[model samples]
Target chain A: MSVLTSSSEAEGEAIVLASLVEGTAPAADDLEALHRRLELAADRDRMLDLAYTTVDSPVGSLLLAATEKGLLRVAFAVEDHDRVLDVLAATVSGRILRAPRRLDRVAFELDEYFARGRRSFDVALDLSLSSGFRQVVQRHLPLIAYGHTETYKQVAEVVGNPRAVRAVGSACATNPLPIVVPCHRVLRTDGGLGGYIGGLEAKTALLALEGVGAR
Target chain B: MNTKKPFEKVVAEHGPTVLRVCRAVLGEHDADDAWSETFLAAMRAYPELPADANVQAWLVTIAHRKAIDVTRLRLRAAVPVGDVPERASTLGVPGALDHELQDALGGLPDKQRRAVALHYLGGLAYAEVAELLGGTADASRRAAADGMRALRLAYAIPERTGAGK
Candidate 1:
């Protein structure tokens, strides 16, 4: 497991990195690496299991969580285990599945959240990052507020690595958690909302929710 | 949970749900205040959270409720005024996109705009957008499609043969 895991992780990081630089959807090889990362993702939620639930919203259905760790993860149109697994094996991990019970709260509450000013998340979580820098990045994730975004340069400063713009970009790209980690909040220093793993449209929509005009 | 930190960990995981809600509910500047309020509510209500339920969704729902309350307050506090114009300027504003594409986007209905924003701006899945806006994926898609269609028709983007001038 260790040897396969190490190899998988190394390859996964590479794929994720490539996708980031190129601005494209991850490929099969990329999913493989992600899977390794998932298996190796921190056991912060060790005792807790992967659970989920479906939440209703304006756009579509959301897989939410009711786990002790709060909302674990949310995926969209996420059927077809083979493909999801392929993605998992390449980027996140095969260990993750439809965690309905663990994430049901996401479904139950997101509608209310979308409609109002209510803040603070009550769910616990498995951050699932693997490096010191990654951990540092996660630390700065929550500082970003709604309706606003921070630049990669700004994130580098917050993480105490003012010059590591590339690293900040990498962190945003490799972020195990997307919406939860709030990587969308990271943008370009030139007032441009930067790349988001979830998709540029989603990034824009999230920003637009703030009534932020445009880029 | 071994991978997560205590209070902060869970908050980090689900903060976006609240943020997304607040973004739609408040102004670009007021969002943080709303977000803080949501989190404070979460902190206050944290102890009573269900032991085995999905918590992230719960927090989002709570945030939504809070957002509605605030929007109501803002609407109520506003004073009636003289007749207002049907459209406001989205062009030439500092920090505005100032592009034709932006103008077309500005012309969309609020729901359509929100849908397009979630799809094109927020990076959420169509399903996620549906979840955020309380609609279906098809509806979200159509809204986005409609938004794009309007842009295409108004700006003649699809009809243009040239890549760029």
Candidate 2:
């Protein structure tokens, strides 16, 4: 491991390094405490640009991410939360941290929604991830309302693009915020569950949660 | 094509190593402050850091600056009597391994201590440590070796190789 040293010299440095490491490794508890404290300080100083956390729900573990502007994305465990965070890092800003405090309000709201104690989400959203037609389609999704279902064609019409029905389906399929955006309420014209970002079971589960009988 | 990862990943990957470096350089009492300051500064500048930048070295550089600031403050604020009572009495007992290690590291000359911390704890190569310390890589290796020898002698670290016998 010693790049510039002769074999004997390298072994000597390695032994010293090992002994120092063994002697001075911080306690696990101390490292954990320091990590927690650093995140909080980062948050308070507004140094953290994007904050994320995971919340367990009836669906599965939901990844909640937010910017200073609002909640940016909600991801399902199936989507691979790590990949989602990486995409967020590459696209948005790399100053993302797993700071749960920034996401506490959203987590609570999601918990309430899963428990059927709430209907609509009061949290602000950052829809910057989607743009143009897809963004238009997603913004209309929340208007489908709790406990109400709309066909993909109907959503296409509502967005003033009846010919863009396929695009509307694509938008719902790619909906970044998933459940909070209420994309599950958009069904096939014949009433079959066409597609969902969180998979068919999650779609059925969400529909059932919203008091909509699954077909 | 920004290939940089989230700052959280950087912190998670290198946090323990950085903390160890801080403790080795600043001692347990002042390490936390240096660590917090280092990462806070890192988070602020993360967006602007080049994607290919050696993130661990960047963090250590910030930490090195923070350590200097803390050391300056420590020197100005040093009072022989004030810190004696604050060290937990329990720490004085034998078998307190970290305290013993910290004392050993604290006793080193500045160049040796820094060389040991940066090369061994910060995971920087001798060349990188030299860049930060303004000297040749060979000189850094020598300083670190000297520091490590002293630490082993003070802390009673046994020689692992039978070649020494």
Candidate 3:
């Protein structure tokens, strides 16, 4: 029996194994069809509440996620897309699917903003990720206007708490919706660029993209 | 906390592998049903799965369950007493080779067949295969070896003869 199980026999087994996998594999189109069917099924069952897709921008790939409530999270590629999804899966329903149709309006707005065709985003905002004073600060960001700057102190005062300057900074730093919320426009009292969750480069790029000069 | 991705990414990464496992276990005709059921069941349970869980192994385990379900359903349907239908031919390149290999795989006993499919096609280790099949790891290994030996005799001989011509 050992004589029959030589190197040639091992090679033969490998060949057979290869043939077996290759032969019975389902077609690529079939898998795609299945995915579409599953997507519809999940949607009908109301299980896929969070839908997301990646959109190319001047900075890099941006992960745009949405729920029926509205556009929820926009993450930079530098933040690690996988980690972002994990957080969404944990905090939000893990019923997330990459159905780009739900993000069509958001993608279009982002594209328009990057192309300098739009000054303000009209997309619906979902602030479920933010709460308390942080939520108050986020709601005030859009009032700063495009191509303009607001000191954290100014934002703190706008939300009716000038003493909450540091809180304003923290809220902007953790802003779940960056570009859409216009958090990059928040600056230091000394006219400094301050911090942005998408990294300083993206902050500078978004500022410059809006013609803010980011100085 | 463990990180989890959207089910779309999961399907893109592992759909083909799962399909192969299903086909290896249930053959072509019923593999589609098994594959669909596996993913549907997986999607339902994906959210509750621990973040750090091994996704491929998890998927293969689901495929194993789905394959068993398919087999049971097929057994029930097969009791009609009419002549059994022929295995449908696959399309495209290597169709003939695939047909021969499918025939060779179809000739094995159930345990040996599953051992070879899970270990060789599904890329599971003998220990994992044993865990899925409820046998000792050693038993799974022996079954795979025996199955492969039989497959070589059944599948490789024709190729060798054709090449020699």
Against the true two-chain complex, what DockQ does each candidate achieve?
0.01, 0.45, 0.38
Model 1: per-residue Cα lDDT over A14-124, one tens digit each:
443332222222234433333223222322324223333455554344444323444434544333323433343334322233334445454444555566543434456
Docking class of 1: incorrect
Docking class of 2: acceptable
Error of 2 at B57 (Å): 1.9
Quote fnat for model 3. 0.54
Cα deviation of A210, candidate 2, in Å = 1.4
lDDT of model number 2: 0.83
Inter-residue clash pairs, candidate 3: none
Candidates' TM-scores?
0.39, 0.89, 0.79
lDDT of 2 by residue, B1-165 (tens): 656888888988888788778777877767778888899889888888988899899999889888888877766676666554322222122332466676777678878988999988998999989998878999999998899878767866554444333
lDDT of 1 by residue, B50-134 (tens): 5565566566556555655665655556564565433232222332122444455456675665565455534456786688777
Better of 1 and 2 by DockQ: 2
lDDT, each prediction: 0.52, 0.83, 0.82
Regions of model 1 farther than 4 Å from truth:
A1-48, A53-71, A76-82, A85-99, B1-165
